[model samples]
Target: MKVINTKIADVKIIEPSVFGDERGFFMETWNQKNFELLVSGKPTLFVQDNHSKSKKGILRGLHYQTKSTQGKLVRVIVGEVFDVAIDMREKSATFGQWVGVYLSANNKRQLWVPEGFAHGFYVTSDEAEFVYKCTDFYDPDSEISILWDDPSINIKWPLIGDPILSKKDENAIYLSDAPKLSL
Candidate 1:
């Protein structure tokens, strides 16, 4: 696997080595040893897994946890998505900065979003099946959401029109009112 650095320090993109033959293909999606070797100092301990499906133009986040803060390893199991991560760590040089990655079943690329960041994604294909492993469990009380179009950190979304959002997401606070994290 190859680890690629993003504009944000805590966010990384990992490309796995695929071995394809006449039948299909195979790749080691996650290996504890390889992860430790490739991503230096990374504590690859995931205790929870989550999956979601979205139609094209649907956006699910700009979401993060405050108490049970989750560090996610995200990847698309089927279809494609435009995944993004925003650095919310107040002391970081790239605070409020963001990075995006195009992840798909075809590419087999994974994005590692450590704690102290907000994560989101838009379905770029007709439909996308997204799955991720989190270092922490889902704690609704600790979860926070940032408005997807907050002016302070205007994210260039690949939306055709108004992307579908949950009621909670539609009511998310803007960055100006959102809480900051200390890494």
Candidate 2:
């Protein structure tokens, strides 16, 4: 696997090694030991796996859990998406800053979003399939959403008309007013 660092400190873009032949190709998606070595600082441990599919122009989140240690390792399995991870750690140097990555089946890139970051994605293809690993189980009560287009952290999304969003995301609060995570 090849680990690519983004502008953000802990955020990363990982590309798996693919071996192709006349028939097809094969690549290992995950190996606990290999993943651990690539991630900086403390070792990561995932407890839950999630998969979702969305149509073009669909935006999912700028969401995270405030009361739980929930880090995510996310990737796109089919189609393409403009994935984003925003730094919400109140005490960090990059607080409120966001980074965007282009993930697609052809590229096979994964984003490792550590605890204290809010994550979301925009489907740039006709349809998209996404999968992710979480360090903790879902906590509805603790889940918090920051408006995707919050002015305070204006994300330069490569938009294609208005994105379809869930009610929760549509009603999400601005980052300035949302509860801060003391990471």
Candidate 3:
């Protein structure tokens, strides 16, 4: 596995070694020891795994949990997406800043969104199957959604038209008014 640093110190792009032949291909998606080294040099335990499918133009986040804040390792398994992570840690140098990465089945890249950041993605293909491992359990009541197009964070979403947002996301507040996480 290879780890690439994003502008925010805590975000990372991971490329796993893939071995292929005439038949097909094989790659280890996760190994506790290796992942720990890539993150914080401590045990990084993922307590939950999630999978979601979305059609093109579907934008699903800028979400974080104020209580059970989750650190996620996400990837695209079927199509492609422009994944984003925003640093919400109040004391960090990159607070309120964001980074976007293109993740696709062909590239097989995974992004590490550390705790204290809001994450979301935009589908860039006809459809996409997204998967992720999370460090904490989901706490719906504690989840907070920030506006996908919040000007303060100014995310450059690659869009063909206005994004299709969920009702929660459509009503999300901007970073300036949203609750922040402290490091």
Candidate 4:
């Protein structure tokens, strides 16, 4: 596996080694020891797994938890998506900065979004099956949604049309007005 750094210090793009033939291809999506060796700093432990399917133009997230924040390792299983992560840690140098990655079944790239970041993705293909492992359990009361297009964060989404958002996402607060995360 290869770990690539993103503009944000702790965010990473992980490329796994793949073996292919005329018929198909295979790669190990996650291995605790391998990840620890490839990524810098402290080790990560994923406790919960979640998956979602979205059609083209659908957008979800820009979400983070105030307590028991989650660090996610996300990848696309069926189609393509433009995944983004924003650094929300107030004391960090890259706070408010964001990075985007293209993830698809064909490319087999995974994004590592640590705690103190809000994550969201736009489906670029007809349909996308996305899955992720989280370090922490979900906490409804601790959830916070930062608006996807907050001027302060200024995420440049790939899709042109109005994105389909959940009621929670559509009503998300701007970064300036949102609660900050502590790393």
Evaluate model 3: give its lDDT. Answer: 0.94
Lowest lDDT sum, 10 consecutive residues, model 4, at: 34-43
User: Which 10 consecutive positions of candidate 3 have the poorest summed lDDT?
Assistant: 36-45
TM-score of each: 0.96, 0.97, 0.98, 0.97
Query: What clash count goes with each model?
Result: 0, 0, 0, 0
Native-referenced Cα lDDT, model 2: 0.91
lDDT, model 1: 0.89
User: Order of all candidates by lDDT, from best down to worst?
Assistant: 3, 4, 2, 1
Inter-residue clash pairs, candidate 1: none
lDDT of candidates 1 onward, in order: 0.89, 0.91, 0.94, 0.92
**lDDT by residue for model 4 (43-147), tens:** 878899999999999999889999999999999999999999998898899988999999999999999998889999999999999999999999989999999
lDDT per residue, candidate 2, 152-175, as tens digits? 999999899998999999999999
Top lDDT prediction, candidate number: 3
Q: What residue pairs clash in candidate 2, if any at all?
A: none
On TM-score, the stronger of 1 and 2 is 2
Please tell me which predicted candidate would have the highest TM-score against the true structure. Answer: 3
* Per-residue lDDT of 19 in model 2: 93
Put down candidate 1 lDDT per residue, 42-92, tens digits, no spaces: 657899999999999899999998777888999999999999899888888
By summed lDDT, the worst window of 10 consecutive residues in model 2 runs over 36-45
